[model samples]
Target: MSGRTPSTRLADTIGARPVSASAVVYPGKVWDVVSEDVDLGRAGTVTREIIRHPGAVGVLALDDEGRVALVHQYRHPVGMTLWELPAGLLDVEGEPPLLAAQRELAEEADLRAGRWDVLLDWVLSPGGSTEAFRCYLARDLSPVPEADRHQRDGEELDMPTEWFDLDEVHTAVLANRLNSPSLVVGVLAAHASRALGWSTVKPADSPWPEHPKLR
Candidate 1:
């Protein structure tokens, strides 16, 4: 085949032994047990490992008014109130990332988008565990007629959903009002879309805001 010879690929399953494991410090519905272990390698050597993970999702919902939806929530970890996009943990078994984004939008903000596109995939924290974040951008939006206040995993989230102009959101970020990555990335992506004239395809009655909040 085109004078190319395929070299044989060798595969091996090296045996490993777990010498010891540390007790989990935190346990949750989806992920549990922060742990450290000594894994004895096939070469008769042991390596210490530690892992901690809590997967999550984030969504940027764009409304026809040239505004982006944001949620104001109290984050206990940072001990402060922060504005963020609709997001939550991927707790459902075999739930697709896009589905999770849709669910999170409805659950967190009582909203949905006519068109949803996944824009970026990233790791929330790579230094510790195998937690990943899937960022999404939603355009042509519609709010859910009814909001279900039920907490998915018994986690209490007292947050209010509000819409801000794209410029306002970007300004809020520079002013430290919107500091979350999802919001930042979403706003940027939407702005890029606007720059490329993607917003013009919609109805002319509602035009993209000319003055983006420069912060």
Candidate 2:
């Protein structure tokens, strides 16, 4: 047998904490707060309060010219409009994450892509929220006529969107100019993917078991 201990091998495996008991402590419009007692083998049981989320999707739309499409919209939480990639929530009933990404790209940027690849996936805050994110790299883009665009409201109304060189976006990500977790991860991941000739990119329909909504 290998020198790795059983406990170490188990940690390397994909595992789920068996839920001994769970209940919603608070229900809200966007998410619900839930308390759960989980059983962790070899480590006694523990209770945790989780923000049950439906998850979300983001797009890094790249044109053939190597420009990335971005949007400037005000986020009330931060009290500032941020520069971010086209993105949206996965709240639509029965909608898959990839489809949500496509819809968001069109809605937020008035654009679409002929090809798409899964750039990366991540959990926003495992300790607090069950929010998972999938950042897609959209290539060979085209414009959606003004008439075909999704109507906007509030912060998104009259939003300003533009295309920036991927290299510049990558630099912003490194310099913390574009620091939203989704944008940062998406831009850097896209740069790395392109460097590998997209070998690192997974098919648009690739499995995303990390999103709690799926579970």
Candidate 3:
């Protein structure tokens, strides 16, 4: 909601054909080419012949000690170590993004938060990918016991978690340590909320005390 929306125009598709069918990427039939006239400058409109993908969710968990939780992992696609907030894809059908954040924290970091609030929900890359990222701020976290932590298979995520003060995390950002955009936005949002003392109270008990935008 911070930036202006893009303008887009779509044209007609004269013909369409299936390119290939795969089990992993496209469980159903996958189309390769299509005849169409599309304008590249617009919003919610595209000339995609293939099936589009759904979006994902991101969580920025803040402890009562005033530190943000970060996860260090190796992204195979990027082929490098990257620091990101605890997050996951909403692979399941019909799952709420904020609730998914709650589940992700418990499973990935062995942490659960007492109060969760939605900070922002926006598309990460609106041009090519159909990925809409929902960012949330979680507070009053409770850690699961060491015996409760379990590592799942098929994930190369060595997410050794750490908590950093806001200033230290901002320093890391300045040094090009953090890469995820959601984390950047989440951290700034959390910092602003904390400064205004908005996130300290439960939303249910004291909803948007002054600002109509927040209400």
Runs of candidate 3 with Cα error greater than 4 angstroms are 1-51, 146-150, 199-215
- Candidate 1 vs 2: which has more lDDT: 2
Superior candidate under TM-score, 2 versus 3: 2
| Residues 166-212, model 3: lDDT tens digits | 77787777677778787777776767777887644233223321211
Q: Which pairs clash inside model 1?
A: 167-213
User: What lDDT would each prediction earn against the true structure?
Assistant: 0.66, 0.87, 0.65
How far in Å is the alpha carbon of 185 misplaced in model 3? 1.9
At residue 93, give the lDDT of candidate 3: 62
For model 1, the stretches where C-alpha displacement exceeds 4 angstroms are 1-30, 33-51, 147-157, 197-215
For model 2, the superposed segments whose C-alpha errors exceed 4 Å read: 1-13
Q: Count steric clashes of candidate 1.
A: 1
Q: Sorted on TM-score, highest at the top, how do the candidates line up?
A: 2, 3, 1
Any idea what lDDT model 3 has? Answer: 0.65
Which of 1 and 2 is the better model by TM-score?
Answer: 2
Which run of 10 residues does model 3 get worst, by summed lDDT?
Answer: 206-215
TM-score of each predicted structure versus truth: 0.66, 0.90, 0.68
